[model samples]
Target: MAFTIPEGLHPDLNPLAWMVGTWRGKGRGEYPTIPTFEFAQEVTFNHDGRPFLNYFSRSWIIDAEGEIIRPGASEVGFWRVKEKNVLEVVISHNTGISEGWVGQFDGPKIQLVMDQGYSAPSAKIVTAGVRLYGLVAGELFYAYDMAAEGQELQAHIWSTLERQVD
Candidate 1:
């Protein structure tokens, strides 16, 4: 499955155009502090003739039979291309967490280092994080590593998502 590059996109946003679509897939979640669980996730990326890509994601905790037991997590964000190879991302989550990430991009992949992080009083704290996301044969391949709850940086989540036609 090859992702199509969106036409008439903002000149500065071309490199990230491959992400301009909806994607859905399944992923696993695990942490030393909590039990492992499986989740069904959907992520959408869209642009409005601007330099930034709008982002949204929603996930659900699922049983072994793939029945949604409850809503899991969700976030909204923007991916901004500042320079040819420089990008910035700001994400706000319904889970009471927000993050700012800076990274470099080479059309297909983006590697980010958390430059700023925030959490609301009612939320859990994530000290820092690293993310690497890219298009692998048209699939959205992404992963996260983070430090939280005194657990040193470790794999937090990873998923391979296929483009959604609608």
Candidate 2:
């Protein structure tokens, strides 16, 4: 089913409105020396006529037969059109990484580049990274470019999620 963008929705949110729903998909992820893991994830985006959307995601490793193995969860803070040219997001992962980002929206896509980073709650200083997101053909796509622990920018992860249900 197709989702209908609510009337009076903010123009700055148009590019992201298509993501307001539930999504389920399988993805492949790699980090450091860890083995390439197969994972299934569910992401939900919701809004209530506000300037920003609410985001939540849950992921877990799955075996070849599609059995869940390990679980991971994250909460994402969102903002759009605050001052007319910026889209911001602050994501907090249970794994101890809190990221802050800001970007600009271009037509059907958005390019969010990481602006800063810090430890959760403590808000200690930390290095930054690069992350980007876009919407294409009814799917939301993401790429992470991070430099942590003295490492250089690397393609940490990429995911494509399609709307599943309202």
Candidate 3:
């Protein structure tokens, strides 16, 4: 399907206009500190005539049959695109971890490396991370690798989501 640039989107965000909609899909997650799991997720990227995109994502643990078993992770953030496709992101998780990421986008693909992070007294500290997002076969493919608790960065979660038509 052809994509139309979202009306009123700031010129600076045109490169990311393809992501300005809600997407839904399932993903798998695993970490050295926890067992592998499956989750259903909904992610949205929207803007209000601004230079940045507002991002939100929520997930729920799912059973083998794809039924939601319970709530999973959620995060809120903003994505900003600068000159030369340079990208900056700031995200805060429900678990009290907040991070700053810097990267660049080439066409439909984006690669971000964590620059720093902050954790609350009760939250786990993630020392480093890498996130990859791309448009593949008309779907959004997302993946993340993270280092935390003295462990080296490795695969953590990944998902494929179809854009929702509204």
TM-score of each: 0.93, 0.81, 0.99
- Output the TM-score of candidate 1: 0.93
Every model: Cα RMSD to truth: 1.5, 2.9, 0.5
Better of 1 and 3 by lDDT: 3
Give the number of the best model, judged by TM-score: 3
The segments of candidate 1 whose C-alpha lies over 4 angstroms from its true place after superposition are: 1-4
For model 3, how does the per-residue alpha-carbon lDDT over 1-166 read when each residue is reduced to its tens digit?
A: 7789999999999999999999999999999899999999999999999899999999999999999999999999999999988999999999999999999999999999999999999999899999999999999999999999988999999999999999
Instruction: For residues 55-94, write the lDDT of model 2, one tens digit per residue.
Output: 7888888899879987855656665555655678877776
Worst 10 residues of 2 by lDDT: 120-129
Quality of model 1 by C-alpha lDDT: 0.88
Collision pairs in model 3: none
Q: Model 3: how far is 146 from its true place, Å?
A: 0.3
Of the two candidates 2 and 3, the one with more favorable TM-score, higher being better, is: 3
Give candidate 3's total backbone clashes.
Answer: 0
User: Which pairs clash inside model 1?
Assistant: none
Q: What's the true lDDT of residue 74 in model 1?
A: 95
Q: Which candidate, 1 or 3, would have the higher TM-score against the true structure?
A: 3
Cα lDDT of model 1 by residue, 1-166, tens digit: 5546687678888778778889999888788998989899999999888878999999999998889999998999999998659989999989899999999988788899999989999988999899989988778998889898789989988888988886
Which of the predicted structures, 1 or 2, would earn the higher lDDT when compared with the native?
1
